[model samples]
Target: MPLRVSRTPTIRHYVMTAPTFFSVEYAINPWMDPTTPVDTHRALDQWDALRRTYKELGHTVELVEPVAGLPDMVYAANGGVLVNGKAVVARFAHPQRAAESDAYAEWMSRHGYPPVRTEHVNEGQGDFLAAGRILLGGHGFRTDIRAHREIARAVGMPVVSLRLVDPRFYHLDTALTVLDDSTVAYYPPAFDAPSCHRLREVFPDALEVADADAHVLGLNAVSDGYHVVLPAAATGFAAQLRAAGFRPVGVDLSELLKGGGSVKCCTLEVHS
Candidate 1:
């Protein structure tokens, strides 16, 4: 099936909330926490600022009620993938996150998004992306191999499964964002040879960022095919992207690091 992606207006509207509104164990696990008073302030500011940035760019903004106990819940976009105006609630691999898929489905319906069923067997939105083709990732997170295949069957688009090598960069978007189907920007070490081969076989000239850049999830990037988003601190990566033809829009997400999230993690891109 042809995946129709509407260019959601430069004024795309996204739903968001702050870490202060919900709690994640952001203190101990270096893999996921950025907990400190400084961290909290930064995270809250980033969340609100990101929403404002989207609005400034012409997208609509809706703030959802923060899920009471889960900090991961604040990174709402992972619970689902919005495709062709429909929302498919992701089946989280982590049992702790299973409840979120249903939550997203209900929220999407209330907001009038085209209804798409929820699945608990798939891991999370970290595994899915849609452009000319459907690309999904299988990382240490909640997304599974079965979920990848199911997404293809459900969405009627070809799916590419990225088996992950690092748990830190748990989502496909953390390292790969399609640049018009003909190009992509990603860090290589997080992926095995077969995975990189599949991507390169299709887009031989795809821009590749070094793994050193991927460590801080530096490769975690977002773009509307017009403006690309990454860490404001990652000036070098931003320069690389800018040089490659995408207008760069950097945001300070150092606060999200405490909760193991970032710009791409904070919002789900509901394509036009």
Candidate 2:
């Protein structure tokens, strides 16, 4: 199908952490198989390419220093959800990633975004996504359902809670991508029946990706109204994005995929 592009592109600010200490030393998600070898050098190279891609596309990219022992800190999107100058810091579900919240919160403070620490388990943007005026909160895995309300109070945005069912797509960003304020693309099976129904009702025009694309973490993407940056392997989703009036820029983060993250996993949008 011919591309049907229309929406005007918007310059966005994003936060990313270098994959300096990136390694799959332990299995936290289904995609993480520590026995599998990880090319740290390749991971760093790929992450740099992703950061460069954002800059080339006219977006501001900020860096958060990666701590020595926090290998998964490279997945910066899990750090927190930043919107309207407020930083709602994450309270990680796993002990391995808990310290990362402090590192990210420190960065936020230094950057002038006062952080609001949540009492409930919330894995930052991994479980919370801002969709238009409302915030989409995902639970049933990394984030507690109770955190949804806490986040809503922190950010002053109406929160919509969605329950995840598949462990493979543990985070909300893993199974769903907010293409624009009112549009989204997702894999319905990753969510519970009610959450799937809620998504349908809220975003009737949402693109439903095939299993092949979803498995490649295609739904994990970042969009600037018109341009959508996604995994290079998600050709099916790329085609869909073009058909739906958006430009798809593919980047290979295959090395970082060893730790179960791709483009969106590494990029955290800063709404300031």
Candidate 3:
């Protein structure tokens, strides 16, 4: 039987990790201070805690094999997007992170997710935002212009390509998040004129997350109706979400952040 996702409904999320959770390239630069045993232990503890939290929260999780030697696989959000009840395998352009998608594809297959297709079109899942319509960002990441159309074709929804500028942010989700059908939290500077126009075309009343809060990837919030989960570090951001009429729940991502991921990266959601 084919498991289907309503165009809008509950999303079952999965978290994957290899043995690399304890041994990852937490820092982008090798020259940075190396990972300490304390950091590793902290990361491992947090990861295990995250798994339990998700299962407790009603989402499914699977810890898969680590990609051969890649240190970043632990922050698996970059691999793909589980949408329309299908696993759309992402083609990441980052030289170091491109291999992560392979594992995502394999896992989706093993789990009976929809067929995996390549979108050499984009590189970062940060750029892929699921909303009333799916929006993909490029100009900053490897999300090719054509990938937007491909995404539309794959899901039978409009995949709008939001313009981006380089060296600003790695993914759109890093700087922005769609809190609901209309509200958004983000760093305003991240969007170019055309991008903002595109957004205004639909959601004219989005909430703006502060730069200080968004800096910690706070804008990358995950929600299911009234419930939301974020990094403990983003307490203020969480409060802001509450102030904006949301029910906020949070968790610690100290270890996950150290590995370049946050709450959103840890879970793949099916928005209701």
Q: All predictions: root-mean-square deviation over Cα?
A: 5.0, 1.4, 6.3
Model 3 sits at a Cα RMSD from the real structure of: 6.3
Q: Any idea what lDDT model 3 has? A: 0.64
| Candidate that would win on lDDT | 2
Model 1 regions more than 4 Å off: 1-13, 26-30, 33-39, 114-120, 139-141
Number of the top-ranking candidate, with TM-score as the measure: 2
Residue 51 lDDT in candidate 3: 71
Report the error of model 2 at residue 231, Å.
0.4
| Model 2 steric clash total | 0
Candidate 2 C-alpha RMSD relative to the actual structure = 1.4
TM-score of each: 0.85, 0.98, 0.82
Local accuracy of candidate 1 as per-residue lDDT tens digits, 189-255 = 7688898898788778678887566666666666667677677776777777767767778887876
Q: Which sequence of candidate numbers ranks them by TM-score, best first? A: 2, 1, 3
In candidate 1, how many Å is residue 173 off? 1.9
lDDT of 3 by residue, 157-208 (tens): 6776776653445567666776665556666677788777776776776666
Cα-based lDDT at residue 245, candidate 1: 66
lDDT for model 2, please. Answer: 0.92
User: Higher-TM-score candidate among 2 and 3?
Assistant: 2
The per-residue C-alpha lDDT of model 3 at residue 49 equals 73
How many pairs collide in each candidate, listed in order? 12, 0, 6
